[model samples]
Target: MANSLPVAVLFGVYLGIVTGIVPALVAWTLGFLFRYVVGVTIPGFGVLVLGISLAGVNGGLLALADPTIVATTDAPTIVTALLVVMMLTLYAHSRGDALGAALPRGAVAWRAIGERTLSVDLAEVFGSEVRIAVEGPVSDIEGFPPLSADTRTAIRETDWRLSADLPIDELQRRLADRIATEFDCAEVSVQIDDRGRASVAAAPELAGVSRRLDAGQRAVSVDALVPTGLVRGDRVTVRTPAETVDGTIVSARSGDPDEPSTAEPVPHSGAATTTGGEGRVTVGVSRADASRLLAVDRAAVIVRSRGRSREIELLSVLRRAGHRVRSVTLGADPPATVADLPGTVLAAETPDGWTITPAADHPLAPDQALFVVGSPETLARLGEVAR
Candidate 1:
């Protein structure tokens, strides 16, 4: 009826049908005024009269549109036709509620639609989803909950691939940075394979610090820039109040001139602070030499020995098969570090507690709660083995 009708006629009929609203509103206003001024109740006779008149006119129009035939056109026939058409119209409208109620439920899927919309948005931006494969010790992923030991172990043991519709390189760098910064690995490798898969590998070792301290010892922040000509590996002497220690310079950093030097230690371990921007140079020395140099105040130094790079592997197969880290309690016969506990590394004891970097070198003590990293199967084995 709506499609076949003239737009102008339909609009006029709509206006006429809604005109009864004015009289109803006026009736309400008059009723309130009558109650206050005349001190008498005003039953809403005005709106009731408008409602009946509107209904009669609407039925008269519907009756004319009805196709029921009569032997002769008469008032009684028209009145009966209007009543029957109105009844049928009302019955159909009533059934609409039941039809709606009969529809199937979709609570679970409907609730998940919000999450699915995010994937759709990503697809619109990136041509295809980027796949990531992280193979290392990591506590969590950005969008995921804190990883469990079982989850981590499963990841390590297998090439677990996750998909995201984001820039490949950016996602790769973000993962690598988080793992390296959190795990305190000496070196991390981030690469993309031919299949557009981003892979990450980290070398988790507390021993890396020991090796650096041993190879060349003096790690001090100095007030003066060591001569630019004296590069890394040149033997240098740093003077302290107590004594002077001599060692090869493993590294040198001229503190940023723009970034004012505050009285703070450098980020690395065994760091010392000096006042003022003139505190430009940092030098590395041997562990033996560092003992003496650390005792004295850093003063202008002179240099002798040559230094060389330690052959540390950039990437190695994850020993735990890419599993997550877990903590377990130690029983009487705690396994030793030399036992080659596959997929498991004894990190810390209850006495020492947890740390950002796992202290894998320590031996398990009896009844000490321990944090261990490995694949799920290995961790399960360790639980039995440690006991």
Candidate 2:
């Protein structure tokens, strides 16, 4: 039976209070627990929808049980009940969220429930103690030539001890210097890892008499009787029937071509042998003097006496003062002149030859290299600018 509008409205409000309001309260309780206990949020609209669904089921059950009790099952009555539940659910959920945010975190409750709290110390994790040592034979770096077998073996056999606190870049540099000096390498590149492994790429120093040649110097071999105890780098004067030519002995081997050449100058004592022997002695001399020396088939060599050199002393002093010499190659668009560089230009190697202590304004070309002397900091800055 259809009821009056006032009675129908009253029955709808009562039905909403019994079914919708209770379900809305249950939904609000679930939202509050999720936010405060689990540290997660349940949307107010989700709770509202759930409460409306529960209210529809409750209303359907009430109608099935007794059709006369509901008084009205119209769309307006159902919408009104759903609206009431939605507003109340949304309001309660918002209040729950506010309370959850205002309270302290749920870690205390977790501890009370016998769950462990996870914590990490960043410094302890990242700041590990470093221990550096030479582990095995040094390997080659890519894009560079490999080191000789002898050099690699020597480096591996030697006892290398580095400070555990040294930076990686410093370690690499010191290792490179040590390898270059001990093994007589012309070029060296070093890389080291945190595990104390080293990779070394090196080029052996060029061998033979041509490496010692300077600008305007020529090596000419002549059939001559060299003075006894004569070795490479000794100043000598060759006397022929026509003229006398001054030169430095590059190599002197008596008849035996397989004998090893010696460059170290040996001291002459009173008991030393003085007799001259027939051999082919390669002498480094000026272009004009080389022509004169080469024209003669036979000559007699007289060793010239020399005093101590000051250049070696200067180099030692400079090394003790922490000065270093580093070579840098220029690119296509290089710095204008020697003056534009950071460190002092000791010398510059050009297509022509080497220029010692070149002037400030000397022009630089592509692929030319400059030997600079400075502290490590200056050299590093120069490298950055060059790159």
For each candidate, give its TM-score against the true structure: 0.24, 0.36
> For residues 199-277, what per-residue lDDT tens digits would candidate 1 score against the true structure?
5545544453345555434466556545544554566777666667666555555546677656553343212223222
Top model by lDDT, which number?
2
Question: What lDDT is reached at residue 271 by model 1?
Answer: 28
Candidate 1: give its CA RMSD in angstroms: 23.3
Q: Model 2, stretches more than 4 Å misplaced?
A: 1-189, 193-197, 202-218, 223-234, 252-280, 286-298, 303-309, 321-387
State candidate 1's TM-score: 0.24
lDDT agreement of model 2 with the native: 0.68
Q: What would the per-residue lDDT of candidate 2 be over residues 129-248, giving only the tens digit for each residue?
A: 232345556666555566768667666666565433345676677777876766657777776665566666677665656786778899998887767767567888988899888888
